[model samples]
Target: MKIISSKIVITVLLVFATVLSFAQKDFQGQAYYQTKTSLDMNFGGRQMSEEQKKQIAERMRSSLEKIFILTFNQSESFYKEEEKLEAPAQGGGNMRFRMMGAGGGEYYKNVKEGKLIQQADLYGKQFLIVDSLPKLNWDMGSESKMIGQYLCFKATAVRKVVGGTAMPFGRNNNENQVEAPTEYTVTAWYTPQIPVSQGPSDYWGLPGLILELHDNNTVILCSKIVLNPTEKEKLKVPSKGKVVTTAEYEKIAQEKEAEMRENSGGRNMGGGGRGPF
Candidate 1:
């Protein structure tokens, strides 16, 4: 009787373990996000002149670029999602570029230099569904929407700042100080489907995968979703350019702009004489 009981216990344990393992979810998908941005240039605490705005707009369009990557794997007990984005010895190819000219003349200029570095942050970053719960402190008012068969909810996230120091030249000198950090809000739409809880860019931490997100000024929309592609590969973390951190990048950019302004003596904001337009 004792021997029979032991056999029955071992069989039940094995079955339970198998079931538990299968209960864990694993998925692989492809998604594309589009962003539309508008630049508001300010000079001397006032709005920039029309001509100045145009020049700044051109520069802004040339400077901004998006950086991200794709990965593939199976869900398993030992799987660590964050490890998938470690730095690759060969480095990930540059993904951001500038759209030059209009119509037939339009072309792309790779802009992976200077302060705009690409590095994935695993500490402060959180995947949408994996991190968020049903309740949050922010407002949840949103229209019902569907994304890839999953019901989505919209919400806004606001970040406010009163005063902060600025390092306008990627320098640690005392001269690099100004009130900046500024206040802004980001609104996003998410869905409960696709269980893993991830999204393009730095936006995440929602009850579901973020399908569409915007900051009132910048719009990022999801165009498509691909599920379990045949390709099985790993995601590589992007390289960190000469400068790291958004603050450091801004400082370097600001210093460059200041130098350009000084060299031009505020006369010629555009033209070949100063430098590349």
Candidate 2:
């Protein structure tokens, strides 16, 4: 009788292990993120007429209201922007495009392997930026908030931004003019129910999925989530574009910014001229 009971217990244990394995493998999710930049381009002691401000605001509308999608599993996530068609070009116009938001690249983060792949575009060129995941020190708070149907906990962290400018390593404009070193507070609300250390763009290292986050003047909120959907494909890491390290990408981006500055006759046009991310 004892031997028979032991055999039964072993069989039950095996079945339980198999079930857990299936659950882990089958869990997947997609998060929709919308980020709005409340950036006042009137900084730097530059003032424009009301008409010029209105025109610039019209041109910056699409850039300010941006959209992103993130597909994630237990340990990995893939992020990209939803493309939009721009208006037709004006005749005999030399209008150039600048990236005004935090979206210069497509990001992939793997928490398990501690690897990251950033697909970035610079000066009409593409680059596959490979580097390690950014480590953010989060201070979990007891306060909680509701995001969609999930109960999320508030967390805060201070991130050391390279400088006042976007690109910390760019040497084009801040040479003689030394901008102050700065930092920004990042606030996020994450829920442990999903159990994935993933979020929009390059944010990660959380106890759960970050549903909403805000940093400086930019706010990224998750409006919807789809969990364990039937129509789904496997997560893939982006490999296309010239392979380079994170530092190398910064160098190339600064060079491009310098070239743009030179072309514009030492004028810092289009805000900060999209640099390394």
Cα lDDT tens digits for candidate 1, 81-198: 1222433333223321112110011011111111111332221331111111122244565455665554566778774422223322223224433444455666777764544334
Error of 1 at 255 (Å): 2.7
lDDT for predicted candidate 1 compared with the true structure: 0.40
Task: List lDDT for all candidates, in order.
Answer: 0.40, 0.71
Q: What TM-score would every model get versus the actual structure?
A: 0.48, 0.79
Candidate 1 regions exceeding 4 Å error are 1-26, 39-139, 160-181, 266-277
Candidate 1 weakest lDDT stretch, 10 residues: 100-109
lDDT of 2 by residue, 118-172 (tens): 8988767889989998888999866765687776778998876531253222234
| Cα distance off (Å), candidate 1, residue 13 | 30
Q: Give residue 242's error in model 1 in angstroms.
A: 3.2
